[model samples]
Each structure stands twice: as structure tokens, then as C-alpha cells.
Target: MPAIAMETYQDHFDRPLQERSSLEPAWLLEHRKQAMTRFTTLGIPTTRNEEWRFTPIGPIAEAPFAPAVSVAQSVDQTVVSHVGFADMECIRLTFVDGRFVEDLSCLRPLHAGVITGSLGQALAAHPELLEQHLLASDWWHAHPFANLSAAMSVDGAFVYVPDGVTMDVPIVLLNVATAPGARVANYPRSLLVLGRSAAASVVECYVGTSYGADLTCALTDIHLGPNAQMDHYLVQRQSPTSFHVGALGASISRDGVFSSLSVQIGAAIARNDIYAHMGGENVECTLNGFYLVDGNRLIDSHTMLDHAYPHCNSHQVYKGILSEHGRGVFNGKIMVRQDAQKTDAKQTNQVLLLSDDAKINTKPQLEIFADDVKCTHGATVGQLDSDALFYLRARGIPLEDAESLLVHAFAADVTDRIRIPIVRQQIDETLLARLPSPQH
Candidate 1:
């Protein structure tokens, strides 16, 4: 008979540290130690938790997965060349099974004062910066997964831009996971810091190959200095049998501008959390997301924009397309503190269901303590319009083709907002090919 299975979460956390903390600097060692303790105390949030009421995580909590480590097998070069943004000219960092592949990366000829490379290397070369910015987000202690990532992450993407510098091209970081035999887990961490008056753009993509039980837990922290500007994009495409939990936290300074677009199209159970803080006056922030879920998949997005000072502005829009019993959840929150007078905020959530079985949960909220501010939020869930389908069918289009056209039209609202031409086109093509077939 097989041995009784142990509790996966406890078993994994109880294991000894993969790397010896004693050999590292005291600050990092203490940080890791405290993070682990906090993770254990918090445990995994259950369905009972208000924030996670809609998404169930039993499959993840029970998976017997070990922390991902470097592998001897090399990734095929062709595989790296064929992924998204391949045609664009940009510095690329490739990782296989959560470990950085130096031979597969291109980081040379970068503009002066711009740093782009691996987090592991950055930890060695720029310890003070890493120590200052790592796990420094206000939301860091609010989630167990964030603590777990901070405790176990070994490698990730790191980018730093100095004062008055601007990157002409976007920087891309790609993560690919392969699990041939057993269940595994990867902790991918990223840190982006911009000095005063700096400007840059970045893309972070996560793709997986193994359609088996696996987990990818990722965390990213971005800080923009005064008068800095930054644009960030995140894409996640895991296998149907994989689980993904990710977080993106940002801090914008006075007169700074920050914007983000997150797209999710894969994973059995995926949850993405985004938090932005306007820490200084006259800051501008925008957050947008799009997700396509199908085949019993569940995608959850939670975002919060905090106006901490006067004259800050924030805007958010999240949209989803669900089919075949797929489920999508969107929760957005905007908070204007007492001191945040002259704040402007707007939020909207929309979902399109292609199948009768498809489901969605959307909630947009705003909390304001300031007497002089403008805030608004709304949510909508709808299916393909029969009138539009009839109009197309009457125009000599086949039934299936007519339905596909309407579906594409419903999704165009979000895709059209994507700034990168290649990224937008790729997503449009993928969604077009996945349009639901007409029923008899």
C-alpha cells in the first residue's frame, strides 16, 4: 500500500532552507527567516476569506511540490526565439524551470546608467539596493504567497534606470516552466527601480510547457522616483494543469507617471493581485487588465489604487471573456485618504460570457475620506448580443463565423488599448482562433 500522503503546504514549508542563510549577509538572512515565519503563521487563505471567497485553492494547497532549482538540461534556442515579442529588438532574459539561462539571454549594449540582468546577480553586486527595495511594498505582509516568494525565490529579473536616462526599447523577461515527471513549484521575483527623471518600459512574460500539477508563484516590486515615468506589461500563460499566483506592487513619487497592462490567458487556477500607491502629489497612475478563460479555468484579478497625497489621479479598467464553464472574478478598490484632496479616480469592470455555463463575479469599490475629490466605479456582465449575431448572419456570414465576429468585437475594447503593436496583434490572433463554434 502507498504511504499516507502528508499535508503538502506544511511539508514544503517544514523542509530546511534550500540555501544556507548563515553564509549570507545578516540583513538578507534575517529577512528570509522572518518571511518564512510569517508565511507559516499566515498559511494559505481559504475560501472563507472574504478576499478569496470566489476562487478555491484546494488543488494548490494539496500539491506535493518542491522548490524549483537549476536543471542540467538546456532549453532549445528555437523555443526561445519563437515566443512573444521575438521580432522586436530588446534585451531579453530567458529562464527555464525558474533558473536563469545565461547563454540564452541578451543584455549587452544597453544605454549607460541602465541596469538589466538577473536578480540573483543583482543581489550579489547591488546588495544595498536590493535590500532597500525588496519586499518593501505595503502589501508584502498582507498575503501568504508574497511571504512565501520572498522566503524561497532564488532568481528573477532585475532592472534599474538612473536619473535622466530613458530606454528607447522595452526590456523583456521570459519564464518557461517544464515538469516532465513530478510536481514542482517556482518562485520568480522581480524588482524595478527608476531614479529621478528616468523613464523606461518593461515586459514580463510567464509561459509553461508541462500540463501537469505545478505552481508558479511570482512577485514584482516597482518604484518610480520623482518626475519618473514607467510603463509595465505582464503576461501569464500556464498549462491547464498548473496553478499561478502573482503580485505587482508599485510606488509612484511626486510628478511621476506609472501605467500597467496585465493579460492572462492560461492556468487552471490563477490569481493576480495589483496594488499601486501614489505617495506624492501630482502623480498619475493607470491599471488595466484582460483575461480569457475557458475549460473550467478560474481567473481572479484584485487591484487597489491608493491616493496618499493631494492632486493624484488613478484610472482602472478590467475586462474578461469566459467560455465553457470558465469563471472570472474582478475586484477593484480605490481609496482616497484625508489629505488626498483634488484626487480623481475612475474604475470599470466588464465581462463577456460566450457559454451559458460561463460565470463571472465583478465588484468595483471606492472609499473616500477627502472632501474634495472625484471617484466613480461600475461593473457589467453580458453575453453576445443576439441582434448583432443576426445582423452578421443576414449579411451572408456563416453562423459560426458570425458568432466569432461578435466575440472578437466584445474583446476588442481591451485589446485595442494595448500599446505594443506586436503584443496586441498576437493576443488578438490568439483570441480570434479560440472563438466559440456555433451550435446547431
Candidate 2:
């Protein structure tokens, strides 16, 4: 396929919604129309936009990415196992090219009253429920991609836990893109809701093979009721020549607890925009991120934590390791509302540049309106400590081995926050595999 002309951003992304809306509910069609309108109104953000100043998206804006709506092929078990955790006890839901593949999924028995399946199925079975939550968050209008997901995405994982329920097993939302001749694009949307006092853990994973440059636009929403608790993890391991843009919106009620660990170790040009809203008082939130890039790849992570209520606590730690001509960006903003007294928030962004050409642009911000809040943010960009490197080499470690050890140690602060053993092990294995590869 030839490259499309560089026209309006909407020209490159104008998907046909009318063709696929016959089976969908009327309300959903209206929702998609509204979302499409919103997306066109917002358009593609440019370098002039402060939030997108560092990440240049010309490849995504101008390239012709075909809508992969009807691919008949399905991946076998071998390909599935190669992308995610090897041995794990969990209820896994799989999607290929943004559509669910039930044959490749393992839907285990979950707790009573719990709902787990693709968003498209849930829309038919529980339309009212889906109406209440799908693309209904306050942050969906923040960027064009968020509304784009709502308008264009056909299927994704949906999990719902009722009040007082506790799910011991994990729920995995696995999405994969194929290496087609044409540069195809997929919009994957996920939603997870936990009722009052409910508890659950979710793993969101994205991966793809080498390609002519596939594009993936993923959006996720999380809503936690009062006293609810959740452990969340996001792992991105797409191919090196792919383009990925992901957006996540979360809201936690009073006394709710939400903890997430994000691992970004893939894609040639990737961007993540995450927002968390504290809805009530005494909420606990933690956001940790780790990214490793090499071979002229670029990864950008932007986060916004809104402390809207009083007595809330948030801790953010983001670390990046860039090599070769790789470039990375981190922009984390913590906002404490006027009534958010005693809001304890601390954020840190640190980077390790492995090559002279590697570059990082980090901005850690704290916008506090309350007088009684304790907020702090800091960012550091540097290379490995020469003294530490020398000491490791003196202890009989090879130069490459010493650097690898330090790199792992540098990323442990974020990876260790993941409580799931399988998730942690997968990350460790990926790190080891990347150590010997010339490209990451």
C-alpha cells in the first residue's frame, strides 16, 4: 500500500462507523457519533500544544493506517504464549486486531454476579450497564485519541465486580496486532469497574510482531467504589516498528485504593496519557512506570493525578533507560485542589542515558491550591555512576554485565512494586532478553 497524502488529521483517521452500527444499540450509535464529533473538533495535538510539545506525531498523523475490521486469521497457542506470561492461573481474554477471539481465551469460573467478557458482548447482554460506564468518564475529551477509541473501537475486555466481592484470580486483557502487508490500525478499549468494598486485580497487556508499521490506539477506564481496592498492571511490548498511543482514565471513591505499575518496553514511537481522579476523601493511589528504549525509538509518558478530596495520598515513580539514539519524555503533574487538605503527594522522574546520543526531556510539576498539602516533585537525567561502574568491574564483572546489573537495579524501584509474581517474572525475562539485543 502506498502512503496517503498529508491532508487533514481527520482524513487519515476517518473510519466508517455506519457500516458496523446495524447490530449496535441506537444509544451506542449516538454515543459513537458524539465521540466522533468530539474527536474531529479536538483534532490531532501538535508540538504547539503544551501537553504534546515534546512528542512529535507526524508518523501517526500522516500515515495511511487501514482499519483492520475483518481479519479471518487467528493466532495459535504458541504465538499467544510467546507474548504473555507463560504459566499463570487466571481468566484470560484475548483480542486480535481489536476484536475478541474467544477460542484463544480461557474464561475460568469467576465469583457469582461477576461479569467478564468482551465489551461488544456486554453491550448486548447488559446495555444499560454498559451505557453507564463506556466512554462516560470526564477525561475522555482530553485528547482526540480518547474519543477516537470510543468512536472507532469495536471490542475490548470488560470486567465488573459487585459490592463486597473478592476475586482471588487475576483477569488479563491481552491485545495483539498482526503483521499485515498494509499498515493497519486498531482501536482497543477496556473498562473495569469494582463496586463498594470489592477487590480485584487486572493485567492489561499489548504486543505485536514485526510489521510494516502497525498502529494501535488503546484506551482504558477504571472506576472504584467506596472502600474498593485494585491492583493494576499495564505492559506494552509491541514490535519495534509500530506506533502506539494509549490513554487511561481512573476515578477512585472515598477510602478506595488503586495501585498500578506500567511497563513500556516496545514500539518505535509510543505515547501514554494517564489520568487519575480522587473523587472522595481518604483515597490511596500509586502510579509507577518503567520504560526502556533503544535504536532510535521514542517513548513518552504523561500523567495527571488530581487530588480533589481531602486526606488523600498519591506516590508516583517513573524511570526511563534510553540507549543508542532513543528519546524519552516524562511529564507528571500532581494537582491538589483547594479543599484537598493534608494531601500527601510525591512524584519522581529519573532517567539513565546509556549512549551519548540518547536524550530525555522530563518535567515533574506540582500545582497545589491547598495550604496544608505536602506535595513534592523531582526529575533527574544522568548516566551510570562512574565510581559504581568501576567498583562493579573491579569485582570481576564484565563491562556489559556491570551495566546490565545497574540497569536492572535502576528499574527495580518500579518493577518491584508489582505484587503479581508472574507479571514480575515476565518483566524480568524481557529485561534479560533486551540486554543482549542491539535494538530494544
TM-score of each: 0.94, 0.94
The 10-residue segment with the lowest total lDDT in model 2: 1-10
For candidate 1, the lDDT comes to 0.83
lDDT tens readout by residue for model 1, 1-440: 01222345445654645445544577876777787778777778878889999988888876456876666274566666556555667788887777788777777687776888888788788888888887466577778888888777777888999999998878888888776456788888888999999998888888877676878889898999999999888888778889899988999999999999998998999999999999899999999989998999999999999999999989888989888889999989999999999999999998888788889988899999999999989998887788888898889999877877777777787778877777778778777776565333
Local distance difference test values of all predictions, in order: 0.83, 0.86
Candidate 1 structure, TM-score to reference:
0.94
lDDT of 2 by residue, 1-440 (tens): 12233233345344454565667877878877787778767777778888889999888776556667655374667667896554678889989889999888888887888999999899889888989987468687868888877877879888999999999889888888885656778999999999999999999999985565888999899999999999989999999889999999899999999998899999989999889999999999999999998988999999999999999999999999988899999999999999999999999999988888888999999898999988889998988888998999999999887877888888887888888888888898888778432222
